[model samples]
Target: MKRLAAYILPVVLLACACAQQPQVSEQTTTDTSTTTPATASAAPSAYDANLAFGPDKVVELKQPESNKVIIKLMFKNGSMSDPKGKEGLTYTTAQMITESGTKDMTVSQIKDKIFPWAAGYGANVDKEVTTFTFAVHQDFLNDFYPIVRGLMLNPAFAEEDFKRVKSNQQNFVDEVIRASSDEEYSKKALEDLLFRGTNYQHMVEGKTTSVQNITLEDVKNHWRNMFTRNNLMIGIAGNYSADFLNKLKADMVQLSDAKPNIPMAGQPNKPNGVQVEIIQKDNALGSAIFTGAPMPVTRSADEFAALMVANSYLGEHRKSYGKLYDKIRTTRSMNYGDYSYIEWYDQGGSFQLPNPGVPRTANYFALWIRPVQIGEGLKQQYAELKDINVGHAHFALRLAMREVDNLIQNGMTQQDFELTRKFLRSYIKLYIQTQEKQLGFLMDSRFYGRQNYIEELDKLLANLTVQDVNNAVKKYWQTENMYITIVTDDSEAEPLKQALLNNTPSPMSYSNLVKEGLPKEVLAEDDQIANYKLNVKDVKIVDSKNTFK
Candidate 1:
């Protein structure tokens, strides 16, 4: 009840204040002595567009609404079915089959076949699923699929090609990580801490550790495990042949077999004890402190909403959580702009970015403070942030989600909506509608090894309530086990470090340390977090309302 009251009180007062305000522009009444009655006004616009996601697999595909077609090809290949230790084997093989040369073709031969149509094409990897795609004229649909199939099914991972591509990816990783700026380093650091580790984490060119070890045999084995008919999901949306569909189906259905394991549902819970690790660079501008806890791998609708409410208090909402910026940075101003967020991840978390100079990491969830503050009042700064009124934070959550639902639904162009539906089609069918398979570990650990979570999530989202939001806060947010992380300049950070070490701490002096530690480069940049200061808004004073925990 108290949780509900905290959020409700501010709104009630705001409602009353609005009632007293002038609504003259929205109304027109003339001269003295004559009374005019007011007519009804239109209701405010509040739409939840996802309410249209619907329950069909074909996706209520809205036609070209225009003539040009959007081509989607499942472009399957023969990879991932073989062995484990040899990872890069199939990737290397693709260079020969699709990059240029195939059965009746040279590099030039492949392009010559399609050049007359002035079409477009591309390719990508998914561990178990890789694809080559093209967008060409509708008239050439029959001609295009045949060429794509020859390229996809016959990929040649030649030795010379493997050496060159592997070298390029390694160089890309080296350059990005080694050259990251101070900000970039901090960003990556956040990612590292967020996910706890990078095992289930996605990596573009793997890590420095894995990249160095990859062999051509690895690519081939990786391809062997993935390339097979049993694992294919093909979607082609354009003007094409119905009779050809049966023929196309016949050509690809012959091959099916077992494959190497794609890592399954394994999500790491928050680390039990509070600990901190620092990444050091000789001249780093400053450090970032990351505060976080494990969040559910997938949240209920209420918890998802409360993620907004919790985040508002933890980091981003300047108007509500702005006090965090003020108490930690502004009172003295060390934060160029520190951000707190429950970073998104459908399964575990992703890898740190390729930038070396910024803070990037994969910690599951975190509130990140950049640079360090050299201060004595460390305890007070931490305590005040917790002293916040979470009810006020709930207001910010409502506003953010209200806008997200509105934007996705009403603001989407028909073309984008169709594409979104298509992108989500497989996901919805496999995870929501059909429910036998879920993405990897999400099924095993979370669903009791059964498919219960599919219905659980649906029912939870369907009957989602405000009370659920309140309960999540009572269970997660208000818990005494909350952890803290603060990143700041190490040398200048000594004061806060000492203060944390010493019980006696000064408030004003500590605030100034947060300011002095910032790099001159960051100070020069007029960033929002850097200059943030707090002056609480003046709302009408109401009778005291106590919210006991």
Candidate 2:
């Protein structure tokens, strides 16, 4: 059983990296009530949970062996919130919090104290949440908590510090925005276009308007809003216990419980369409084309497990569609590079997942490619996808990663092992559902939503027939299964656009359709250059074949 394997995994170690302990084998789990630490040692251990962490004051003890601890706090420092399209406000505020003067320490002194802890701590700021994370060795847990609390709770919001961080962020925006041709920017933009009209559309960098309007006070305010006792979750997994819990409580006494001031969850609207936003320039050595749209993963026939397996095949590349580009473009001389990605963000007002801001009603997949051989290159990719057949090999990763994840994350420190065990339970539930589905289908032909994702995924992989995956390909993961594309500076870009427009089997109107290679004009168009907008309608959801002459 899934639980049986997980329970026994601590009996062995997988492999070790330099300066780090061997990775514990694991499978991902759902949230669960915690169990006490095992009274005896099974085998060699990573870190003794008994020695590393203390019990949480806020949450009840459930799983004590969890490696990662999630701690939430109730603190409100609503210095500033960003205005639409006025990016970079939340970050501008965070800078004021940490780098600026604080009540207990000057900005310089604060950074110096926290330096040993945070190599790269903070990210993903928006109107809703601003985070400051500083990670240290489990041994340094008690030692570092106070320093973080001081920076977070008692900030000076100094004027001079405000001026400096804002200037630095502004410079970064100017430089990064200007370098639109870089591979990363092209990929990032492609994602933004797909998930447009949501707060997720903006990255950690808030908008320019938001940044400009942000005052020192506004920055402080956003920080203030993030900390509520109920809204916060704190998990410290290592060798720790009751004494450590008391010490943490004493240290964090300043953080009193506020009302349930958790930030509102990200609502999932039934948003559809793939919008396009392109940046054009001359002499861009290569083009970047991102194709994507919102997908229904959480509420669909394919569950997270199924989707994970399906998406893994679409990308023989690394994170965010880079692999496909290289194999097709760099390897075959198609273009510069290619990439792909599928992810779900958790938001509220829809299906609920454990992690907030995790996927609820939605999942998004992105593909990036620079075409050196446009016609053939695009054709090659779809052809490969068309023939993609999932088998034990394809889904083997689910087994491996799940186990690895379970082993690594399984423990008492994390009171919630329900998620992990739930997934495992579903593994058993897989075969049972298959049998039930057959009976229901024969009885009425009206059986629907009968496929439980986790159970079905295991059965599907364990007994995957070629026809099974091919059928899914025909039904769901086809080339015509809705997508988007953006191409940066290239002489080949326009010709490729022309080719897509004049598809022999399915011709389309290109006059106002595929945006031509051109620059963006905010106020008015310069007469000589073509001004293009990758409008929402331009989001190509590759669906049924259109009428062909």
Candidate 3:
């Protein structure tokens, strides 16, 4: 139905953003498959067969009436394929290929050529896959194909481009990402802890020192290994002739077929107790708290969909209806938001749905408590008055963990389960409302070794019971021991650490004018929660600038 909806409601769903179209050719063979309306009796395959260009090519097409098209060349290798010390090599290479000029055109010339056509390219680099994308009008098919084809096959690889691209990436780590946002910092730190000593440890953009060490030769070598025919899959959606598709496939096949063996990322070592890595920055007013434990399930697991249901009820990303949001944000106004994820959710704070091409074999359950004001003022009054005297991060972590503890101990209520299930059933439609997004999800379905994630999830959600969600939560979600990463002021480091060690009581602080401070029963329940002891494994504070280097 998600697939069918793209064509059915093109005006409402699709936008001007799409992909490449090729020249028509009478000699070329084209797929003549017709779009079929979805029905209960109809098998998914009855809707559309998984079309192919050749032996190695995987193509999924949606023929909407719009002139725009979305073409993606998805490579199986991503940052994980980068050689040691050459981390971010794949990402750098992708930028060099797409952003830099092609063989036939210089950087300036390529920009000039595409500027008039209003055609541009994008790249999504994940731990395991790197997808190169292009969206353009059908009228510019012949003109744009050469430019995109040139980029894929014959990149300029100029010394200037290497320096420019590499510098931009390094500066992002040093400035925007690592320096500015504690929320982002904590998330990165948790991922590092969760995937410690694995290829997945570094950011997709690579670490600062890693980017500094990467040479143009290294980028070229990494590209040669990763960007090959066997490692590639292409997706197209929009208005385009059959001959254009064939031409596009034929051009893509010109690339080499070397399939380099990418090493599988090993499971992260589980911490015995609460292990913390605090990035101490004196300028920081608040701490970004991230807590998570590695889970052994992927989308392929039977319990995955049920856990998905439970995850939504517990802390659906971005939505305010979840338990965590209700408890920490709605009732208490502790922070901007609180959310949880069963799978790796990129741009969780930004996007509602998961991005495509970022497939991870090893997954984890994570909680993100958005940055809140920490010490000294109205913010510190909550802790100071209670005699807890720790930062907001400490209290937020405790309160959020209490919710997790409750979730595991007393699972979801029947009403909550039904509400979340129904919400998800309708809410999921927005995930792939557009043709570009729908195509991305389809490609992701291929990555997870599933027939179709949406279709499978819908069926799973339909038959799922309250018992199923709770059982899955018990099996996968844990609160006893986990990794915690906090990014906060240097002043708050020791105080937060001591608070954790002392098993501090951080009860809610309300105004005096409120006749009812908190419900007596709620306050009584929180007293037990406030004293809940956290088993400390290890705690260390590192200079903020020193991190991701």
Candidate 4:
């Protein structure tokens, strides 16, 4: 769970290496339609000629020279549709269909058949969509497609599979997340606080009690109700033949024709001031801090492109060139990493690119100040500093907020803006290096009512001026009102809470050898960061054992 995006450079290199490969040009359409399948009269010419759009909702990216095929079946329903008492229903139901066996095949038998083909299919359940993605060589498509068809149309839903998946999900919320990974734990806690009363409040895995309460019958009912033609969107890529595509669509029509009334998630609760939740965990090594506030704009907004430049300049995922990473990790060595996001970045610890199928209508501004040293590790590193009971948690928080405030007060310089915008224009091309990812992004574009998202964003970035970015920064970003979550050792929780409330000065601590190398100006600036004011409105301390209960 403490996984870092350490391989981002290699991923970029791989994308660059494959830049010369042939790709299908993205085509645009003027159609603005809803969930209904496109009629023959309403379909665009490019799709009509290629059979990419028709009675079935299909999004295809064809590459004639490639040897692989990628198929994705996406549904509009996800965790946001969960009922009040059964919060993990949608996610559990998705697992039941994809991870379990079909009516004709056992799980072991299906795996045995597909193992020789070097092909696999899996499911991803996010806040707004559940996508089943399949990748195989074109030679194996004839055999692999039937297995996928069975899983979608006729799942077994055996009691054993249901029990196993439910137990694992319960353990995830009850034990693994709380004990093994404070980094993810702090991030989840922050969302819980930020969207406290909304449907988005719970984790996709749901809570400990909700998962335990789910039964096999509940999964069956959910599948029958939500998996319908109205919620479906089909996407295929690679060197797939039109004949095979037609066959796939014919089989997908066997799904239930009934449409369920699923509504979009409403707005999240706004933060009154600087609200905080301090989680006390035993044997914790350091404090993991996650700060966020609700953002009014989504990708559909005109200002999003400008904010993209601002976000990249502030902190671009795992890249070390960002201002936050430069100040927190590169300069002070306070943590493993520091990053920020304007949109939801799923699994920041693992993925280098934005995972395509997890698009959301609502979003937030998040700052992830990775876990910093505390307790014995801190005392051993900086033996000279007195009154360092809670280590550098306070100082790190103040510094991060102060930098954000600086950005809000005075936007990026013209030089900084130009550099970041140019980098982003080229950097986004790396997002779709493979056929599977390309299809995923194409489907995401439909969700946001765009013809081609990456192309549109690149064009926007190309035309933007420094004033556009600064204006977006001033309009969308703020440091005054936010929700903060800190996961720290039980011994240091009370002290950290008091320091936050008292607005105490938290000076930097360093070993004698390291302090000798620092410049005079750096030490002088440290004094200012130490005393930065935080308008902390409320603070609550909760034990780890009691969380997600």
What number of backbone clashes does candidate 2 have, counting pairs of residues 3 or more apart or in separate chains? 102
Candidate No. with top lDDT = 4
Per-prediction tally of clashes? 75, 102, 5, 0
lDDT of 4 by residue, 313-399 (tens): 888888899988988898888888888898878777677788788889879999999998775577765567544766878888998
Sort the candidates on TM-score, descending order: 4, 3, 2, 1
Any idea how many clashes model 1 has?
Answer: 75
Assess candidate 3 and give its lDDT. 0.73
Better of 3 and 4 by TM-score: 4
**Higher-TM-score candidate of 2 and 3:** 3
TM-score of each: 0.50, 0.54, 0.87, 0.92
**Please, what are the lDDT tens digits per residue for candidate 1 over residues 134-236?**
4556666667666655655554555665666666555544554434444443444434443433332323234444456777666555444555443443333
> Candidate 2's residue-wise lDDT over 430-449, tens digit each?
22222111221111111123
lDDT of each structure?
A: 0.36, 0.37, 0.73, 0.80
342: Cα error in model 3, Å? 0.8
Task: Give lDDT tens digits, candidate 3, residues 17-106.
Answer: 443332111222344434332232433231132222432245555565566677888888878888888787888888778657877788
- RMSD of candidates 1 onward, in order: 21.2, 17.2, 8.1, 4.7
* Regions of candidate 1 where Cα sits further than 4 Å from its true position: 1-62, 66-143, 181-198, 201-204, 236-256, 288-292, 299-363, 368-465, 476-549
Model 4 per-residue lDDT at 511: 72
The C-alpha stretches of model 2 lying farther than 4 A from their native spots are 1-87, 114-131, 138-142, 246-277, 298-302, 316-327, 335-337, 344-361, 370-487, 490-499, 504-549
